[model samples]
Target: MQKPEIQQLLDKSFSDFTTFIGSLSDHRFIVSPEGKWSAGQQLDHLIRSAKPVNKALSMPRFFLRWFGKPAKASRSFEEIRDVYRDRLQHGAVSTRPYIPPVTEIGQRETLLKQFDQQKSKMIGLVGNWDEPELDRYQLPHPLLGKLTTREVLYFTIYHNYHHLHTLQLREKPEQPWPTQLERVIF
Candidate 1:
C-alpha cells in the first residue's frame, strides 16, 4: 500500500478494534477464557507491539538506514500474512516483550487511550516519509526479521486485524474456540 492507504488502514483498523473493545462489558473486557487473552489484554498487546513500529517510524532516516536496505524486494501484504500464519502453525508465539500483563477492568479506559495515542503517533510519523522512503528503509520485526518500512506497515495493519479477529471470536464462546493458529490466521 502507498503511504496514504497505509495511514488510512492504520487509522481505520485501530479505530475499529478500539471501538469493539470499548463496547464490551467491563467484566468481559477483563475476563479471558481458558488460556486466552481477554479483550483488555489484547488491547495491551497491540499497544506493546505498536510502540516499536512507531519508534522506528519516528527515527531519523540516517538511524533507520543502519539496518540496511532489503536484500530482496519487500513482501506483499499477503506474503507477510502467509509467513506469519506459517510461523504460528509452527509454534511461533509472542516473545517476552510482547506478552501483555493481566489487564484489569479498571484499566480499560487507560489502555484504550494508550492505543489511540500510539496509533495517532504512528500515523503522523508515517506521513513524514515519501513512498520510496518506505521501501528504502528496513526495520527489525521480532518474528519476521528485517522488513522494509512498507512491509512493517503491512504487518502492523494485519496485526491489528489479527487481534481484532481473536477478540471477535472471544465474543462467541458457544461456538467452539478456534485453535491457536486458527484464532489469528483465519
Candidate 2:
C-alpha cells in the first residue's frame, strides 16, 4: 500500500522469479510449447514491463505533475488486479514493444542481471516518494486507462504473479516447474 511495502513486493517478486528461472535449464527456458511463452520469454516480458517503470520514475516531478492530474481516489491493489484479469479473460494482449523475443540464446544471465538493476533502480525511486506523492501522481495503464503511482506499483506486484500463473498453467503435469507455483510468495 505504501512505498516500502510496494518496494518489498517488487524486490521479492523479481527475486522469486529469478530464482524460479535460475532453477530451469536453458532448453526448458527457451522452448515455447503449444504456442505459449517459454520460460525465458516470460522473464523477458517481466524485464520489459519493469524497464518502463524505471524510466517513468526517473523523470522530473514537475513533468509528471504537468502531464497528469492527481487521482480523485486511490484504487486498492485488488481492484487494479481484477481489472487486468478481466481484460486478459476478454482477449487483451501486451503491446508489441512489451512482448519479449522468443529466443535470446545464452542471454539468461545478462537478462537476469539487467532485471536486478532495474529492480534496484525502482526501489530507490519509490523510496524517495512518500504516500501522498504516490497517490498524487498518475501513470497511464493500457487496460485500466490511468493509475496512480501507488496503483502502478501494486499492478507490478500482481503482474509478476499473473505471468507466473500462466506459465505454470502451461507446464506439463510431470514437470517440477508446475509445483513451484504452489509456493508462490506473492
Count of residue pairs whose backbone atoms collide, per candidate: 0, 0
Candidate 1 local Cα displacement, residue 1, angstroms: 1.5
Stretches of candidate 1 off by over 4 Å are 173-186
Computed on alpha carbons, the lDDT of every model, listed in order, comes to 0.89, 0.81
lDDT of 2 by residue, 1-186 (tens): 777779899988877777878877777788765667888888888889988887878887788876478548878999989988899889999989888876675888888888888888989999888788888888887777778888889898898888777766666567565354443422
Model 1 TM-score (2 dp): 0.91
What lDDT tens digits, residue by residue, belong to model 1 across residues 21-139?
97887877887766688888899999999999999988889998789878988789999999998988899999999999999888988999999999999999999999889889999
lDDT score for candidate 2 against the true structure: 0.81
- Global Cα lDDT for candidate 1: 0.89
